[model samples]
Target: MTEISRRALVQRLVASTAFVSGASPLSAAPAPNRSPPPPAPPGKFEFDDVVRRARDLAAAPFEPVAPPLPDALNKLDFDAWRDLRFRPDKAFPIGDSFQLQLFHLGHLYRRPVTINTIRDGIPTPIPYSANLFDYGRTKLDKPLPVNLGFAGFRLHYPLNAPKVFDEVIAFLGASYFRVLGRDQRYGMSARALAVNAGTEAEEFPFFREFWIETPESGADRATVYALLDGDSTTGAFRFDIYPGVDTAIEASVTLFPRKPGVKFGLAPLTSMFFIGENDHRFSSDFRPELHDSDGLLMHSGTGEWIWRPLRNPPKPEVSSFLDKDIRGFGLLQRDRDFDHYQDLDLAYEMRPSYFVEPRENWGEGRVDLVELPTGHETSDNIVATFQPKDSPEPNKPFNYGYRLIASLNPAKLSPNGRTLNTYQTTAAALGSPEPINPGSRRFIIDFVGDDLRYYFSDPQLVEVVPSTSQGKIVRSFIVPNPHTKGFRAAIDVQLEPGQSTDLRAFLRSGSRALTETWTFPWRAS
Candidate 1:
């Protein structure tokens, strides 16, 4: 839980940017001398310049650059902090395709980030001004300091409608950002990197500055460059964002470690899984399920696809899948039925899933999934990332490239059959002569896909392959699911009292597998 706070606390609700005008009284205007760096000369500004800064910074002791925020802003609550919004008229436009909206420094976001817009090879730093924002209902007795910088920024484009600008992507907090495609609500978020994520000694790297290239008229994409700094490392990143029905961001990252043997996770994702189809801890609630994502989807270099159902464990849990030349992976929301959630305000079904596609061969690494026990829906309890076997050397450059896709149709990324839903209950049935076995449980998994539908008529040929790491599989069988035009695999497991079990199962026809292997971690009550 302490580590969660180190990396800026995850926000479940989208940060509002609504603009209105109001003012208040403050005692004194406490201004810091902090200001953004001077603009680079035309033709001199480049990605290499960011790399040089990172390299130079990594060579020195990490001096965190967080100046104290004014008391007027420091004392404000969430509602009052959100009331301060960037004026729409102050938004920086990029050609005719996209615009950038700034975030004010207050509340949970006390760290400031420098923002610059590059046009025709010249970089222009955006200065902070009270005129840029509409302070709604906030009473500042004294005027705000001129040196107060921005917290972060969000990018907007006409994604859903041709004329109306919708938020496409946002970069805020500590190297944290979320993207949205058409009709998708903010849910899970992607991070530039995670340092010592699954360990007790976790570190959060912050993106301290950004340089965005102004797009040309009629261009469909935008380029953004960023500088990240932390206690262990410094980095330079380039993100090329494309907005569409399935928005994508191609990320090129270069890291320079300040110390040797530091654990680094590339392309990490953060999400919430308070409850789901397989978890009944809070079934008394009106909603059938509540979660931003249902499962962890992975495609190994061996071409085997794996699905692990998310859980809210009794304690912190970390699972790693060993692999070589990793292909792809992501935290996905497979259940999209509105009836499954039934929440009108949140619209959980419309939350987009993020898929990480590696642009190069990242050889010999493990995909790590960390799930922390949580009682509230606001906390992001699930984190997934890829950790390389070899640690980056001190003062050496480490580079990786990947494509992050935010979409409503993550199912299309998988070629094999996928698990539609998972359920668990006591193995005993009423009226049976057999005594109730408290240690026994039954797991029901339904899988659906294009290939599975073809073998629905010949259910006899399909087989359910089940395995348990610490339990006996009493019985395993497959039955046709007429409703989904797929097959349901049921397994009765007898577990040892007070022991936990790791279960894996998949559907197969003859010698060929029809679906991705479904994995789950079950703990005794």
Candidate 2:
């Protein structure tokens, strides 16, 4: 098998089996017998109780647990794991609006998590059964234990079709969960909290237990409560998720740190960026771009919208924008044209862009973007989060709340104008004869919206405000795009050798801003 296929096969195998064992497949060992734990006490299962439990757990050192998979069952490959499907009839019913599905433990997911159903303020653990799964090609000579916990959980609802149920949200990896809007596929992932990200000693806090509240009949929303545990931090998170054309999750988080001065990242998003219009690493048979997200969109407190295109660089790069009481930020997949992504199966055009809007003032901090080098698009290499300027003191409690909007449409923070596209070409093409020079680069930026069209049509009405550091502007022009009905700006810049340039541009009509500020970084080779 090829290397890619072999790796995929191994991941599938590991994802399906709960554990690895050296025991014989036919040898039947008596299943471990254990009593069912008592249900959570009444009125003792409030959100504060969840936080208290997490804080208690964080007071102790981190303890890793091993999955309980029999050696015979652990040896099952991807195909075998696929055969072990969950029985449809045994699916957990969560009111009329949503249902719950459990993922089995195996290769990719070895850590088992506790799943509980909260009904009328009480928490009840859901026990696992071997019969709940239909082991397809894998032969199981002996029955499995009943207490085998789940790997993770997925939330399902009528997302696209009326009669068919689709998975809208999922909680799997370390405190990581993904949600999809109507007709939108998963792209970026959001975490409950991030501690020490982009640092040499980073920590991944995980959701060890989840409490899914049973929805009422005809309810349009579902509530999920989770307990986050890490080496130095503990948190309680409550998510009120509404799935639709624009799926939204309103989250309230309370964190207690085991150690003081821990850097906390709020509303953190993770994605992948292999190549795009700005950075084309390899020649491919498909379209010109391949990425989960194209740019980082931010709405500053001053009501200015900023678009920063994502890049896959040769080394790790971290950029931070300091702001106080920020409004919102997200990783957007603005390019929705199917022609942009030739791969019809993955449907990159239909992937959702997640925006995090703070409900209240978040004080002072910086929106940090981290881009890492990746050889392929399959690996996630982009991270964006809000890093607080002041670290929370150890043993001190902190609370943060935010609303996440997941949609296929671009965020409408302003009705005026926004960035449509950004591209780079040879500066020499713009009247320069030195076509082989590496320092000469021309950038083309397009701004679209109703305001731009209104301002540009009047003579001497609109002017392009452009600035650059460490570069000289050779030529600049603004014109209307006949195809898109938008204002396009083209600028030729000559960068100094061994120097990087930061370019900023915006459209204004007599001091009235017509478009969002466009900022980009150019590094000379």
Candidate 3:
């Protein structure tokens, strides 16, 4: 069956289950789970214990389990779910610096995730109580079970405003977790691990349980441990989260593959790229651009900076940048103009960009980007991950660690110039009677930096170095854009039919480079 038909069938099944459970018609039933048996007893509950549990679970055949959601809780619709609020007084106080708020199971989140709080080296499971939540207008059945568990949890701290505790981190569906920096709204999501993404057989590993280590008074950070389970792999993860101006989370992951030759994506990120300045296919709105991230920024092993604009293509597109012992990569929302996205409620402009910095050398691999076609901005269509050239062998353990930073401001790892904006325009000016050029396309790129400004200020001080692999560079020029106080590089390229071009451009003053190299792929219409 087609993907659309399969999706429709799943939707119908979810609706039917919700209806039978007396939930709202629009609510999706809990995901059909292929559950594993309870883990065997270990001498000690350590990181290895988590991996052992995952491996033992994967050894047995998968069994599906239906989450037990009470009728009253399951009946909540969107509005009703929003109305259910956790009591502030009951929040899990992790010292005076941080607190944890539990989310109730309803609406989109129907399955409960196990949560345990660690204090003074002892682990205690957080019990669920209906009284902990206040159902504003939605009446619920009395005396809910204390063992009902929780859908997810959020971490709150006074990062932005001193008078208020802002939500800085959240753990929701599967192995996904989103974090925010000071004065930044959440955007992209990071996973503990990804297996075989973009391949014919893709598997999503989920964190079934979490252990949050309580911090002491005056402590500025905390640590969270999770156990990940999948059909072919099992893993353990530890994240040390520090929320501030440049919120950073240091993660250490150890994976144990059940079978050999399993492709693993270390430090995977999921985001959305609808319509942007670079590529505008369906332009019915006037906002100019709408996206969580505008481009993929990578710091190569040779200290070269590379920037590739994100695209919402007509079809699923997967691009890979081969590298050896890469330094870092991230999905960056470089466009910070509020006028670019006119949506006040969502505050797309203030959304944080995530950067993944490797702690150790990861041998030859590629930073892969998977762009899935999306009709609307609601669905996340962009996925970026690290694909190691070598596959992990069975029964052996593989380990990797990295630091992830979520910040409202763009990363400043390099002092070199940065891409301010990228836009596409007609090759020929309006009202011109020039002959139409089908293969000719014009692209405008803006570079901003103090060094670039000083170098370009002098007359005849800078030159544009542009190259294309599969296309002829018809024209190229560099000029100062007065509006942005930056230099703008315009280039027009003519491609052959059914051909694509990989173009690269950078500004240089004499022998000195002034900007981080910008690269893009142009396809013939």
Candidate 4:
């Protein structure tokens, strides 16, 4: 298999049956004489209990400690780890709708997390045992500790087909979690919190424990609770996940700061963008475009929408859009055509775009989008978050909530014209001479929306308005593209050597705005 296909099979867990719970096929019989496990001590449980624990943890000096795992297990390679599968019969079966599977501790994922099943408001912890897994290889004949714990877990449900028991969502590797809608494959991921992100001393607070509530028969939803701990912040998170057309997760978080908040990101969405329509200086591949996400879309509080195309620049880049009472923002994979990405495996078109809708006004914050340089498609190079202007004092209370919708289309989030795609060519292509100034570049930004109506009949009436912050607008115009049925806004700009420019454009006619704002940052190579 190709590298990406192998990675998708491994990372996406498409063939995770061995990982789910059995050294053999899921239909294989369990060890004879093994009976169902009895739930641990049950006690009154509620989301507030997690909040109390986090609050208490923040009151004391932060403890950055984790129990060490067995050296043999720690030294296992990826292939060896993949061979160790959880026995499916050992999963905590919640009717026919949900099944829970645990991840084994290994080299990369060393930190152990607590897992529990909530019954009637009481939580019963699930202990670890070597018999629960099938050790296919590596000569692991020695027995492991009873409290060996687990790395993370995955939830299974019949999303696409009945009796298929497709994996729906997973909480694994730090505070990361991802969900797959009906036909969408895994792409971008979401996090609980980001402390001092993008700075020299940035900290990644992890979810130390998870509490998964029991699912009812034939239920289409489940809830999970998490406790986040780190050097800078301790927080409690509750996620109510509903799987459907656009798998939506309603998130409620409460954070307690251990130190004064310097900088942080809320509802951060992380993705990869190795190469796309905007930048292609580094690509030598067969596919026309390759990325988990292509652009960042935002809906401002003032009822304005904006689209910023993503890029893999020579150096790391970050941009912020300041606003009060922010509405929503996310990294989106808008291009769904398979022709755009011709790879038969790792279907990029099946990736879903996540749009986070704030349940209430998130007062005084800037949507920060950070793009880092990456060499391959495997590494995530993009992060977008809502950075609140004012952070809560140390040891004080802070709370926020939002709804994350995993969909291909972010409808109703913005009603204005949408940016279809962005491409760049030399200024000479736009009627300039060869070797036309080294500082000159032309851009073709296609925007389509309700505003494009009637513009075809009176094409010359509509205009493309463009402006730059640190350069001269060499030329600008708007023309109709019969192929896209949308107006293409073309602009040429001249920049000095080593100069960077912020360009903005939108469709307009007679003192009225015709399209949502399109923003791009350009640096002369």
CA-lDDT, candidates in order: 0.82, 0.75, 0.76, 0.78
Range of the 10 consecutive residues with the lowest summed lDDT in candidate 3: 19-28
Off by over 4 Å in 4: 1-43, 411-413, 430-435, 451-453
User: Could you tell which candidate, 3 or 4, scores higher by lDDT?
Assistant: 4
Steric collisions counted per model: 8, 10, 1, 5
Count clashing pairs, candidate 2: 10
Estimated TM-score per prediction?
0.91, 0.88, 0.87, 0.89
Which residue segments of model 2 deviate by more than 4 Å?
1-44, 65-69, 72-83, 140-142, 411-414, 430-438
**Cα RMSD for candidates in order:** 10.3, 10.8, 9.3, 10.5
* Cα lDDT tens digits for candidate 3, 1-525: 111111111212211111111110001111113232223245434556566676676676543343668888777777998888899888898768889998887776666778998776567899988778888998876777788877788899999888688898998766778999888887778877777776656666666788887766877787788877777787788787887888888787887787787889889888888888776787787677778888888888787788888988766667778888788888999888888898878888988899888878888888887777777777787788888889988667788888888977774644678888888877876688987588888889998875766755673788888988777998899888768677999988899777877788988888987888888777777
> Quick one: ranking by TM-score, best first?
1, 4, 2, 3
lDDT of 3: 0.76
- Write the residue-wise lDDT of candidate 2 on 1-525 in tens digits: 111122122122212212111111000111113232235456657677788887788777877555557666567666765676777778788887888988776645556689999877778988988867877767878766677787789989999998778999998766778899898888778888877777754677777889998866887788888988877788899888888888888788888888877788899988877778766765564677788899988887776777888887766666778787788888999888888788778888888898888867888888887777667877787788988889887676788888888889884544558887898888755575665556877888888885665655662677778878666877887887766677778878777687777777888888788887788777777
Candidate achieving the largest TM-score: 1
Ranking by lDDT: 1, 4, 3, 2
lDDT of 1 by residue, 1-525 (tens): 111232344321112221111110000011112232335565667778888988988888897758888888888777998899999888889878999999888887888789999887788888888889899998777777766778889999999999898899999888989999999999988999999876656778988899998877888888899999999999999888889898888888899999888999999999989888877775488888889999988888887888988987666777778888778889999899999999999999999999888878888878888887778787888888999989999889999888888888866778789999999977755567877577889899999985888899889989999988776998888889999999988988888787777788999888999999888877666
lDDT of 1: 0.82
lDDT of 2 at 250: 78
